[model samples]
Target chain A: MSGKLFRNFSFLSATLSFFLLVGIFAILFTYAQDAMHAFGIDFLFNETWEADEDDEGGVFGGFIPIVGTLLSTIIAMVIATPLAMGIAIFLTEIASPKISKGVSVAIELLAAIPSIIYGMWGLFYFAPIVQKTVGGDGVGLLTAGIVLAIMIIPFMASITRDSMNTTPLVLKESAYAMGATKFEVIKDVIMPYAKGGIIGSIILALGRALGETMAVAFLIGSVMSLPHRITDPTTSIPVLLANNFAEAQDLEMSAMYYLALVLFVVSFVIISAAKFYFFGKKAK
Target chain B: MNRLFVNKLILGLSTLSAVIGIGFLFWILITLSYKGITSIHWSTFTNDLVEGGIRNLLVGQFTMAILASFLAVPLGMMAGIYLREYGHGSKLASVIRNLSDVMMSAPSIVIGVFVFALLVDPFGGYNGWAGIVALAIMMIPIIISTTDNMLALVPKELREAGIALGGSKHKIILQIVIKAAKVGITTGILLSFARIIGETAPLLFTSANNQFFTMDLNGQFPSLTVSIYNLATYPDEASRELAWAASFILTMIVLCINLIGRFVIRNKK
Candidate 1:
């Protein structure tokens, strides 16, 4: 009876602990109800962003930041995905064991650097160079994408490297025996086997890039409009949330929650998509 | 016949890509160090943020981090213990694990909004406590994941030994299992510390950066990362210099925590 009671108690604690996430989701969903009714289905379709400063808490639209988030993340993935795969390929195949380990460890350390540092560096050093070559003063959609690309490369490369490393040795040896070149073996054998992980890593990077704040908040020009050009200023969901959450009142605050709910749901889908890649392998 | 050339070309390109990835790290470090060291001074720590010193920001960071640790560790450890010891392989355990994994990658800023709703609004203000709650939530998932993995690594033989000695499940877990897995648990704690210390987004609205230093958890507080963001955006040279200096300080703290965590985990292995 004592053991039974202890077991029940422990289980109860665990169950309660798990509900914290449920609570978070609850609060977000409940608070966002006001804006859901206010904005209706057009919340996403409305392309213009205007927050009335004249009224204490006024009408606002999140469409521009949503666009910015999508655009910047797409740009980052476009730039980082192939480069990250290349780095992974190099680590798993081309580099010597010693050099690979050294570089791999360095990449791990690179991941340890915080998002804020990346933003600061982008705003200071990287943006200036970008300004010189890429046009505008470097604080725009392009700079934000570049910074995010730099930030997510370590994640994408490390995950992909692990996937590549796990490719069966027998398969590769057989490919080599067929008189195939190294490139052929990778393209035909390794990549096909590790495709799930590669896709997962890229999606994971996308999710991170999408929700990234602070760094993008600094580098992205924070203008609330649809960006027609790479050099055009824009905002993202996270940056908008961080920049305005303090002063927001009533409907404005609820609108932020609505935006938060949007971010929450999008990231949830993207993160689960990342898991689909791993679950395929994890099933084995 | 042309396979050798193709192989050589792909290999060179891939290697170059890896070099570029590594190259960015070095360039950032060198530049940050150069800018940080040249501008940092003794007065920087002795004065206020707008005036000079980051003393308040450092204190606030430590306070909020410690508060977060207090909230995160015991709860996370308990949840981990429940998953590993009591509920292992159960449907509930699997569900909890999946949720934890999803939450692990959830956006931090949304967490800010959640805290703003629950704590910031109810408490009637932005204070260090709200920030602590947000950071603690962020810290929780990481600790649960690590603690579950680490506790599982504690050998079954050890648990069997405890059982043979007529030890109860509670005692076995608290004494033998936790003690055996202590190093890994410590590593997880340190890693979570490294994670929370550098986070800016959750704190962006929760702690709500102040220009002056204050020990009051009830008041808006300064933090290193948040200040660095506010500072770096300024167009002037002096504020930019101070921003770099603060970034250096913040980077070093985060790097040291991570390196120490790596060192400890390596030693344990």
Candidate 2:
């Protein structure tokens, strides 16, 4: 009877906790619905954001911000993925354990620093450096993208290294015994085995890049239009939300809310997919 | 001979990139310190933010962070405890865990916007209390995930042993289970502290920045992060220098917290 009572209590608490968790999503969905009703689907595709009064005739195209987000994130991935993979291969396959431990800790410390510091550094030091070297205005998609790549490299490298390390040692040894070169063994056996984890890490990093705000806000000049060149001034969705939500008119506020909802959904899907791919089977 | 040299060359190139990456991080720290450390004097700590000092901002950050952690840790621990211990195959538990994961990864700015909509706009003014609420919401999911992870690490045999001793479920958790997981729990709290201390975007909408010192949780307050943002943008080089200094201070606090957390966990083993 005591055992049964304990079990029932545990079940009750678990159920209550779950309901609370789902409640957060429900609240987000309700807010999204209200925001959508206020603006309609046009809120998403509209680009013009004239929040000023008297002349409220601007269309609500969100393409610029969306493009800004995708462009910077893609740029970051392009820069970070190769470096991260190289670092991972170096750490797991080549470095001695003592050196690897030290390097790993240093990378983890990089991850723990605040995003705002990154913003401050970018605004003060990095932006000027870029402006001087690139021979143009500092603020653009390229600058923001490079800063993000540096910020995210540690995240991607650590995860990739862990996954690569998990590759069966025996398999690598057998390939080596058969006279396969180190690079050949890695390309053939290790990379394939860790493919799921590597993909998951990239997806996670992409999610982070899409959602980052303070750093991007500092680097990306808040031009609401899409740039034809990577070095052209542009605005991302998160930066727009940060810039506009403070003094937004009612319609603009609702539109910003809609944008926020879209961002939330995109990140939610990416993270959920990564989780399912990486941990779903083991979870059962 | 050429092929062998080529392999060595490839290895050297990869090693060089890794060294460069590590070097970049140290460069940032050294630069920040050089720019900011000169301003770290006595007057800076005793004066208010309006007078070009961060005394009030420092106090406000400490107070708000502690309050938010106080609210977040208990509730998060309860939720985590419930999920890990009581949640077997329950649909509700699975949903909650998934939602918590999503919430954990949601951008800090989104949380700010949500809190602004839910609390500040309705209240018709920015308040420190609203900021606290926002930070707490951000902290909760992290705490819950950490606590659940730590609890999961507790051995099944220990739990069974407690059960066999005629202790109630709650007693078992309160006594045997949590005691074993104390180091992990402390690490979670420390990580949460590190996380909330540096957050800026969420506070942007929830707690409007104040130049003067204010202590009331219901009143406007300035934090280290908001102050840094405000300072970094000023036309004055002094303010920019101060911002770097403040950034250094904030980073030190976070690094110390993380190091202490690791130490605690390591010592426990």
Best TM-score among the predictions, by candidate number: 1
**Candidate 2 chain A: 10-residue stretch with minimal lDDT:** A13-22
**Which stretch of 10 consecutive residues in model 2 chain B shows the poorest summed lDDT?**
B1-10
Q: Candidate 1's residue-wise lDDT over A1-284, tens digit each?
A: 36666566657656654587778789998998877888876877776555567645456677888889999999899999988999999999988999998999888778888899999899878988988998886789999998899999999999999999999999999999998889999999999999888898888888889898988998899888788889888899999898987777777778888888889989988887788655452411
In model 2, what is the error at residue A79, expressed in angstroms? 1.0
For model 2, the DockQ equals 0.47
Give TM-scores of the second chain, every candidate.
0.96, 0.95
Candidate 2's residue-wise lDDT over B5-26, tens digit each?
A: 6557666766776886797689
DockQ of each: 0.62, 0.47
- Among all candidates shown, the one with the greatest DockQ: 1
Which pairs of residues collide in model 1?
B44-B53, B47-B53
lDDT for each residue of candidate 2 in A70-189, tens digit (9 for 90 to 100): 999999999999888888888998889999888887887788888888888887788889888875589889889988998899999999998898998899999999977777777889
Q: Which ten residues in a row have the lowest lDDT in candidate 1 chain B?
A: B94-103
Model 1, position B92: C-alpha lDDT score = 82
